[model samples]
Target: MTALTTPREASDRGGPVADIGPLPARRGRRQHRLAPLIFISAAVVLFILFFLWPGALGLLYSFTDYRGVGDLNFIGTENYRELVGDDDFYRALGRTFLYTALAVPAHYVVSLAVAVLLTSKTAKGKSIARVVFFLPWLLSPIVTGVVWRWLFGENFGFVNHVITQLGGSSVAWQTDGTLGLLVVVIAGTWASTAFNMLLFIAAIRNIPRSYLEAAEIDGASPAQRFFKIQLPLLAPTSFLVILLTTIGAMKEFAMIQALNGGGPGTENMLMVQYIYRTGFERADIGYASAVSMVLMLILVVVALIQMRFDRKSALS
Candidate 1:
């Protein structure tokens, strides 16, 4: 027996068939993938417009006689040529490096020691000590410099008063070239120690207790355990702290301004202060821009070197 569909029924089933191929579906899929990018595109545009565009313009203006206003003229490396012979700028540059070299190590060592003490079982009032130590870090660098300036005051300061009470002559801490720079370093070290201490503290606590217990069971002395175990583990954290502290030290300006205003005839002048005084006070905008570009290059080179060193150290 055979059952057959009629022609009307076959036409009814096939009447609405139409082909829409993979191209249209692929177009729909592409839009689905691009939807998230729409939300993030505004931030990307803003960064390029504000940061990248301004930076590029600054680099261009460095080579021209753009006096922060008025007509601009193409000077063709004249600003850079003048910078090569600027003795004051060179001196400020040297002082900045010297301060960084001194302050970074001093801060690192002292902060590590304090962090060890605070995290030790024998230490008392750990929370209170941490709070007191970190309070100075919370203060603005300008405020720290101002307060230290008062403390370094010749006669009326508490430090001078104490010296007088002890029958010692009052000392001028900021007039001598060497002493002035040393005071600046001391103030910077004090201001930054707490933050580094906190970093070291957290790093030390993260070390596995099992390693220490194992070392002790093997009859290792505390010093032996620390040097052989803890120091090796902390190398990464040490690298990070050094890198950050070095950069911060290099850009020091607020403290220098509030402390001595780059006084004593540029004894305490730093790179940033030099740039500021040149661009604003002297109205040498072109030269200032050139100097700033040089600084940016120096920082970039140093940072690259540091990163390479850190990577090798960590691998070893």
Candidate 2:
């Protein structure tokens, strides 16, 4: 027990002390890293199981002829090739694109313009206006769709009734191919725009009144102050909301399907509706999976582009 080793012996021996004591080597610190590691590991595992695993399997299935009946077989790009010539695919894609394009900017502009109006002046109608505006978004989409479907129906629609009351013929509000699509877009926009408007109102309210006061003191008009100051700060949120709305509009099957049943030669058929028809009605799950994968790719590209624009707008 009294034996003392020289420094040379200790160095030469390279024994347990260096690995276990004194510095306690690299391995011991690894145990200290376990808590964070455990958290990260669990997250990764859940991510793989819930989202990534399913997505990967779906992507693989996209290339095969599974048909939801038998074992999946690898066909090697045949589904994609067929998808290239698929007319319904293109038509649905076009409708979805148009819906997102027209509906998004229209809602943002109309709603923001209304919010701007409401935010100004000491008016008695403000609270009631806010509630009325927000009430549509509060209802379930199915309920909203059902009510609006009757309100836009070709035979008994309220809008056509109004036109008739004004001495006009009952218009084909949801019968003509293009007009039916427009009705869906308008109704969809009406149901959702109020939600966006409330957000703008909240954002506008949170901004300091001192800035507006300062602007007003300098003879800056309401428009000038809003454009020069408040809007710039709200740009990030607005961009994000638009992104969400655009994506939602792209996948809007329920409203379109419920309203017109993708009527008039399936002109109102959205991408999701097409996929649904292919899968269930046509009972071609393989082809449907292929179509879905294509839709996913399109959405991903669109989202990336919007994010890039938002980022650039923020930086600028």
The C-alpha lDDT values of all candidates are 0.87, 0.83
Tens digits of per-residue lDDT for model 1, 180-292: 88888888988999999999999999999999999999999988988999888999889989989988999999987998787667888999999999889988788888888
* Model 2 deviation from native, Cα RMSD in Å: 5.4
Clashes of 2: 0
TM-score on alpha carbons, each prediction: 0.85, 0.81
Give residue 56's error in model 1 in angstroms: 2.0
Q: How close is candidate 1 to the true structure, as a TM-score?
A: 0.85
RMSD each, Å: 5.4, 5.4
- Which candidate number maximizes lDDT? 1
**On a 0 to 100 scale, what is the lDDT of residue 193 in model 1?**
90
Measured by TM-score, how close is model 2 to the native structure?
Answer: 0.81
Summarize candidate 2's per-residue lDDT along 1-316 as a digit string, tens digits.
7877766677889953444345566667877898799989999999999989988877888888887788988998999999999887898899888888888887888788878878988666988888888898887777777888888876888888888899989877766887887888788888887878888888889889899899999999977998999998788769877888888888887777777778877888888999999988987877888888888888899899999998787778
Can you give the lDDT of residue 113 in candidate 2? Answer: 80
